[model samples]
Target: MNPPNDPRTAADDDAALRALYGRAQAQISAGTTARLHRARHAATTGSTASPARRSWAWPAAAGFAALFALAIGMQSLAPPAPPTATPAPVLAEADGAAALDDGVADALATYEESPDFYLWLAANESTLLAME
Candidate 1:
């Protein structure tokens, strides 16, 4: 007969299952029990990692990391294309260099001396700056 549902809480249900499992286990043969015992032992004692796996994992990971670092460092070795155009070294602070600097002073002097020139410079200021 089937068990009653009422008055049987989880502990009662667990006792019933244990009794059923005991009866089922009592009926099994000796050879089947030994095979089951061996299978259980082998499974519980199994090593998930083998020696061959340990041999290569760290070395392979390290080699790939080194190669990646090498690729990153090689980026700076090309010397940046020599800047394509070198700016001529200015011979600043010399007598001749002072004359080259006086062009702006000379223009400013002309503007200050002539009122018409000052108006012309004010009008052309944007164009003059853009050309420079």
Candidate 2:
């Protein structure tokens, strides 16, 4: 049943909102009402026409799926490349006559150049320890 006062319940509220549209027809200006009608008509017509344009989305998706399937099929049908051969690891060696020739040369050079220092260190090591 319709309430005599302002709407309180949900049904009354919904009915009150619906009645506002009829009231708006008398209150709103003629130019504003005509613009609203044109806008509503345009929106409904645009939505009905959109499905014809949106139908391309499905076919585009199907084409992409077909391309992906074709790529996978082609890859499986083709032969794989051959494995590469690796070279064997080499062993490093020196001739017996020249084995570590630089180590012996360095030791002999230092001893020959500073024989006096080596001799002094050997003779005076005990005195050095006493000083420490």
Q: For this target, which candidate reaches the highest TM-score against the unseen true structure?
A: 2
Local accuracy of candidate 1 as per-residue lDDT tens digits, 1-132: 545666657668899999999999999999999988877877798943345768888999999999999988998675676556867666764767788779879987877799887678788998889899
- For residue 21, what is the lDDT in candidate 1? 100
- TM-score, one value per model: 0.32, 0.39
* Least accurate 10 contiguous residues by lDDT in model 2: 88-97
**What is the alpha-carbon RMSD of candidate 2 to the true structure?**
17.7
Give lDDT tens digits, candidate 2, residues 8-90.
67677788888997897789998998988877998987755345888899999999999999999999999999999987644
lDDT of 1: 0.81
The Cα RMSD of model 1 versus the native structure comes to 14.8
What is the TM-score (0 to 1) of candidate 2?
A: 0.39
Lowest lDDT sum, 10 consecutive residues, model 1, at: 1-10
lDDT of each: 0.81, 0.81
Error of 1 at 50 (Å): 3.0
On the 0 to 100 scale, the lDDT of residue 83 in model 1 is: 50
